[model samples]
Target: MTGLAKPQGVKRMQVVIHAGAAFTDDGRLLGSLLANKAALAQSRSLPLGPRHSRQFVKVMSDSVIKDVPVDDAQEDLREIFPEDLNAERLIISSDKFFGPRRTALQHGQIYPFAAKRTAYSEKLLEGAQLELFVGLVNPGSFIPKILMSLHEDQRESILGSTDLSCLSWLNMIDDLGDLAPGVKLTLWENEDTPLIWGDIVRAMAGLADDVALKDEYALLLSLLTGTGKTQLLELIQQGTAKDRQSLRDSLAGIFEDHAQPEQIEEELDLPGWNSDIVSAFSELYEQDLAKIHTMPNVRVLHP
Candidate 1:
């Protein structure tokens, strides 16, 4: 008996196990089971039997266990376990590994949805913060609500209605609307943009007196254009005699510089010249004098 063929003396061991997380598909669950079995076999020093050997019986059961539908795993595992015996392990470790892994998978799958909810919450918080800041700054006023109610384009329109210099004061209101708590120091400091309309008015008044009328006129024209100058002149033309006299004095230098010298000589000699020359000169003088008188404030030059 030449040892009844040495292979016949080798005892084949077999075990079966089932384990998985709730959402494990068949292939993944099978892979997990094989991995667990390999780990157990490596630890226990067992020669694993073939996965489909009829000599093996199901030794473990779980919700995750199901018959293999196709031959992919069989082909892959053929070389590793050639003996006709199926081996498996208890699914306890498999269940433990997959439980949390399954939960993590589920969480990752729905992560986008959770992120959207977080973003919406952040926007709501931002709105609440903005509202609270506005309330604190305005105290008794409802300007913040009014600003919020307006469309973006309308906000600029409303701002335009107020003076440009007042923008920094308005920004104080805006800062209060959106600023953090420690930013109070910004309010205590003076801004380059002025806050008071009265200051602008006083400056304009000073310019009105200290600057020459032409300079004032040019300044006004530069700021407001030719139509504004025409309107201002029309208004002055409608004023009382005293007001007109003052305007005339302010404007007299302009008119005198533009008057004709021939007209001046003719007007001075008006009552006693040769008739022909006198008539011709008289007509010319009359026309020129009329032109000068129509100006703001030219005086006749005497000879």
Candidate 2:
């Protein structure tokens, strides 16, 4: 005996949350998705822009902090995403979802509150499917970037007693899986983003196999030399690299010859961080990435 009869057999919405671990996309990914917003809408997926995503984050944060019930949180979301929404999938991209970048290294851990925040995000999803997409960077570069983003006083406070070697993306992933169960987690290396950007966009936008978006190679092209860019574009135009793997394979060869090393290489200069430490962090990162490749409840997208 309800006030209004429920609609029969309507599909549930699927929510894709891009929870940044920071300095990964730097808003570029969202920018790329926004570029294809028209196409995305045609495919029944709405990529929430920065304003909408901020509103969503604020609503979820208030609910989590104020102990607001799930129903109330959902009602708040309805204001942002109307009940008559025409999309089957909603995409929200925000690095802040992992917490502020300044607190990234707190308690000797990377994104210590990621799992908890993710759980809160899930609570507001109502009946929709939730997918968490996280982009991870090597702590060698990741730590330096984080420090550079913080003020002098804030850096030391966040790095309190933290052993840099102890930071592991694998651990963060495990925590996300254990603490935020029932949500699919998709991961890719920031280093490999140039190669796999197409797949990432498709997954985030919930695009069908035949639905193609423009500028999938924008990142890859930026790092390419003049000739490299020409050949890569020609390869795509001529159907040489017809699929994701084939394109990746072709791009790898081109990168060897035409990638601008200066653009591809990240210059690292920070207090107490040297070549040796960076190398060690990189080695550990590779090892962790290998282990993550085999983990359950996770999908690791590779170049």
Candidate 3:
């Protein structure tokens, strides 16, 4: 694709779409990034582009806020992005792209998300420079969350029929390809939030490799209380990289020691799911994560 046209002689704009694999981000990525844009730019945490917040908002809104008529999208883009603004990239972050997160029945069937099969069919960023970034969670946790969102009516028809054992998050992600053909897709497991949080921010910004970043630890600060990250940092600081098992062990210990007791606990009020079922589901979740790590063209961001 030639990319979204800019002014007569301006540079092409890079667009990043953070299509949510729900129950993942919880708004921290966009919230913290936008809040610190000014300071971040000063420190060169992200690639510098349109420096003004107003200009930045325009770029994001036009791409994600509402429908930009298929016929006039190019014209609309030119208006939203003035060449003089020198916008380096546009980012549209949304969980709504695929529709509400829900499943009427269990047994591994995810509902309505199929509509997302064509969600990007409009080619919202058709001619523009575009990149798609998605976060995924194992069906173990994801399936339950979708059930929680169900209304009274939906609960019976949908939640009543779910069998958590048969869920597959990989299938959902793989489906995106057929819907939005030929798009460059990047996949990262949300379960690794703490370790790869910085990478996520950097990747989204389309920043350079050498740009020294400040506040890299800011994302974890909230989740990891005092002394919570010490051991993990020490392990990472060691000359040799640790194995997956060791890393997981260190992180689990640190988080257990530092995480707020209440925060770590979950209350899944769904029927047919007691602590045992949940634990089994969680075990399966870990297995799914392992499988995801091996997929081709899908980048798994780890420490």
Candidate 4:
């Protein structure tokens, strides 16, 4: 791997870290940001691909966990981000940044170490401005999926004595606020991603409102039928959806009629779970979102 050089006498480094709540995104967010690399570069923003992200995680682990010197850690960063790149802002993303799936429900709750992790990363970045973006999934769907990702023997151990009803994404956000209070935090619901996909990408890239992007509809397109895709392209080509809001409104209308059933539907087959439990979880998630909106220093993107 190439070494990163410490940036000097350039723009103050701004680091955007996309910490995924597991099952929310599998690099699709990063992929979307990457699709507009040329556009991002025009604004002096660099989005690190998976290789750089992994290198970053390794450096952070070595520095914080293995007691490597801060200087050494900064040197390792030089490999991931060359000094000559001179980018003003850097974007790094990984779902595992929040911790592996097995560790997600630690301490009888979700991501209890999240705040400390964020703080450690900030410190290791040599005081770069920190921004965190995360997408939250309703536990009704999130829990079962995460549980399924784990080994059978490991599942019960991680979830010991925790009440499913008590799991709250807001609690995790609150911890971030209290511990890494200086970090800018951005959040959105996974379900709302398709609708707010453009906004999410623009926010992460710090792109101007008037700036345009390619593949903005990639995620939304993946979930649509051929007919839906054709209709959407026509809508855009004809300039029917003049603004962001109007485009989103048009997509909503199209999705209602043409979204693929299997792609949009989340299957739940966990033991002792039913429609009622899922509905209750969805209700709690909505309530948590309301409280999240009121949080200071946090930006919640909506459709």
Model number with the top TM-score? 2
Candidate closer to the true structure by TM-score (higher is better), 1 or 2: 2
Off by over 4 Å in 3: 1-3, 6-12, 38-69, 72-85, 102-122, 160-164, 209-214, 229-253
Q: How would you encode candidate 3's per-residue C-alpha lDDT over 58-148 as one tens digit per residue? A: 4434544366555554454554445554346666566544545543234365534533433443354554565667787655566667777
Q: How close is candidate 4 to the true structure, as a TM-score?
A: 0.92
Q: What is the Å distance of residue 267 in model 4 from its true position?
A: 2.2
Model 2, which residues run further than 4 Å from truth?
A: 1-8, 242-244
Clashes of each: 2, 0, 5, 5
The lDDT of each candidate is: 0.27, 0.82, 0.58, 0.82
lDDT of 4 by residue, 52-99 (tens): 998887778656667777777777787787747658789999887767
Q: What's the ranking of the predictions by TM-score, best on top?
A: 2, 4, 3, 1
What lDDT score goes with residue 259 in model 1? 30
Per residue, candidate 1 scores C-alpha lDDT tens digits across 168-247 of: 12223232224333111111111101111112211212222222222223322333334544554564467633653465
TM-score of 1: 0.14
Query: In candidate 4, which residue pairs clash?
Result: 3-78, 3-79, 4-78, 4-79, 5-78
- What's the TM-score of each model vs. the native? 0.14, 0.92, 0.71, 0.92
Q: How many angstroms is residue 201 displaced in model 4 relative to the true structure, after the best TM-score fit?
A: 1.4
Give the lDDT of residue 136 in candidate 2.
88
